[model samples]
Target chain A: MPKDSALPSRNGAASPGKEPRTARGRETLRRLLDAAAAEFGERGFHEASISGITRRAGTALGSFYTYFDSKDSIFSALVTHMSQSVAAAAAAAVAPGSTGVRREREALAGFLAFARQHKELYRIIDEAEFADPDAYRAHYMGTAKRIAARFDESVAAGTMSPGDNEVRAWAAMGMNVFLGLRFGVWGEEREPDDVAAEAERLLRDGLGPRG
Target chain B: MPKDSALPSRNGAASPGKEPRTARGRETLRRLLDAAAAEFGERGFHEASISGITRRAGTALGSFYTYFDSKDSIFSALVTHMSQSVAAAAAAAVAPGSTGVRREREALAGFLAFARQHKELYRIIDEAEFADPDAYRAHYMGTAKRIAARFDESVAAGTMSPGDNEVRAWAAMGMNVFLGLRFGVWGEEREPDDVAAEAERLLRDGLGPRG
Candidate 1:
């Protein structure tokens, strides 16, 4: 049977796979998230209408309800998507054996590259962060924890100074947040590489092992 | 004959003093600007209604127009009020003979303290920066010139190293924008002192002389 065969995939019980069902569901979700992101970014979290999102995605308005209970629910989903994507790329920026400076550069570079690609996503996150503080705090604290672990590793290896890890963590988080605001969020015309380099330079001088 | 007169006996020029203005005009302008700042800050620049502002200030709708032509005019007037107040404080913070690190520290401290006292006004500035990028850029660049001048003076006196004054000026600007968004606009529960200290630490490290 051809791999493209729909019937075998439909009845593909050998692997118990749900191909078509999963494909359409995932595609619907992808479209909704993308559309919601654009809508929320432009109209703001509170102002953007669900009907507008559905229209933008060319999906039935009812379909939006199937995926998201409310606009805030869609916002939560976007945060999850952004968090997961940041986590995946974060590991590359801080592999087990990298030095503190090397990891700092990679992390800054990773974030700038990610931010450049998802400029609108960053906008959504920023607007969400402003419109509702507690909700965004949850999103922020979770992401900060992931980056904080990298800071911890640097301290453990003596590649970075031993300071209050929590304070240092927040500072590190601020650095990334500010970097994104400068280049991506604020619509400033700066090259991502230049920003990453500047961030890396600052981190090395500021947080590297204190002699 | 009375000191309380609208035209207080002034150091009159040889020519009759210019058409006398009452303190009432100044008082009306103050109330109008404050009311607009509060309304715009809370409801957002785009969503705020002019009627709401006049009502809040205990003035008739017509009175609002008497003080300002339109919402855009009110915004222009408020922006001028805000930029001048904050810029003067920042300029004082980085005045000549001030240590570079200390100057930056005081500036951030002054800003956060100002925000802590007038949360509404700060939010108005923050929201406007996002909603109206052109106005924000003009405001930001205006401040950046001051910072650059301070940095240039430091270099001339051999108090600070010469580098990209323009780039460093921008970094200074970005630092304030990010911190304002995080601490001021978003209203995180952290103390103003703590936020200011953390920000100052970052700037001192980020913009110090290149080794």
Candidate 2:
């Protein structure tokens, strides 16, 4: 979950024998993925081209093939890469020993910040529904599972109520995603802290009128 | 909000001068939209063809032209049509005099059922992000506004706590959307009632431990 770990290698994302071995190679891989994010995020999957990604990365076509076999391969890798980056961002945001709703709030705030910085994240993941179905499903399924685990931990620590953690996790994830889209990606009129505060209040206290 | 009102006419969906006047014309327009839904849902906007929609609709190519100028027009119309259908479904689900969390629960349940029945709903709307950005923004913006209005009503009725209704609306919508995708479209392991029950619990009283 380290910030540096957000960058995926062959083991994490790249296809066979395409992994970057050195720090310089890793930098080049990061550049290509960032460029792919721009290319795919701007032009979408179909209209996006390998040459476009390379041009954006300022790398030669040979450098592109050194990392990815095709546009599809890099796209698939980029999705995975972004997913990891999201996880890293959230992990870095949460304070150690934080539990329950407080933990979720920090995570959400982190996500909003990430979304604002990487406005293309939503577009790429959404496009994956058509361009790469497995990656799309894997991203959500994986994130939901991690969230459910957090719920279990909170419950065991007596910091949170116990219920259907899986359902709650999905619900929580959905809230964060949409909040990111509206407040983070679409517009940044509201501060991340303000948005996360409202969300945290809802997560901690629900909509029922207080006594 | 009536179920029958889900169907869109020229004023509701079609381009200028394309509104169906005759009952049969209305029926043909309905068929074309339904067919467009399937065509776009399965093949996607880029790959979907007017002929494919007509073929699925069992209408002539000329019939397609009668109501729509081209595939783009129909896709835009279909987005509007589906948005209306979702609104109608939610409206029909809430019982008279319902308020607060209970009303939101019913709306989510209604949406879950609708998603189950129309598995293609998510695909078409998600595709609108790329195929039709205006329609996509309008759809979410409009839905969020409606949800916020419901929150205002609930607060006035003293059944729900006062907060940022806009934020709450977007969060509620995100929850319902993901729930639909997971339980309604992706799988049917859980009944709508059961899923809605859990979501209701979360919305009514969040993850905080009981006193």
Q: TM for chain B in all models?
A: 0.77, 0.95
**Cα RMSDs of all predictions?**
8.2, 2.5
Q: Write the per-residue lDDT of candidate 2 for residues A1-211, one digit (tens) a residue.
A: 4356644443356666887777777788889989999999999999999999999999999999988899999999999988988988998999999999999999999999999999999999999999999999999999999999999999999999999998999899999999999999999899899999999999999998888
The per-residue C-alpha lDDT of model 1 at residue B114 equals 65
Interface RMSD of each: 6.0, 0.6
lDDT tens digits, residue span A1-211, model 1: 4444443312231112322246576577778777877888777766788898999999998777766667776776666566656656666655667766568667767776677677776657656545655646776677667656766777677776544445445556666765665575565587776776666665555422233
Q: Which 10-residue window of candidate 2 chain A scores lowest in summed lDDT? A: A2-11
Taking all chains together, each candidate's TM-score versus the true structure is 0.75, 0.96
Best by TM-score: 2
Q: Which 10-residue window of candidate 2 chain B scores lowest in summed lDDT?
A: B1-10
Stretches > 4 Å off in candidate 2: A1-11, B1-11
- Model 1 C-alpha lDDT per residue in residues B88-204, reported as the tens digit of each score: 666555556675556766787677666666677655665555565566667766787887787687667665555556555655666565465456655657776777676656555
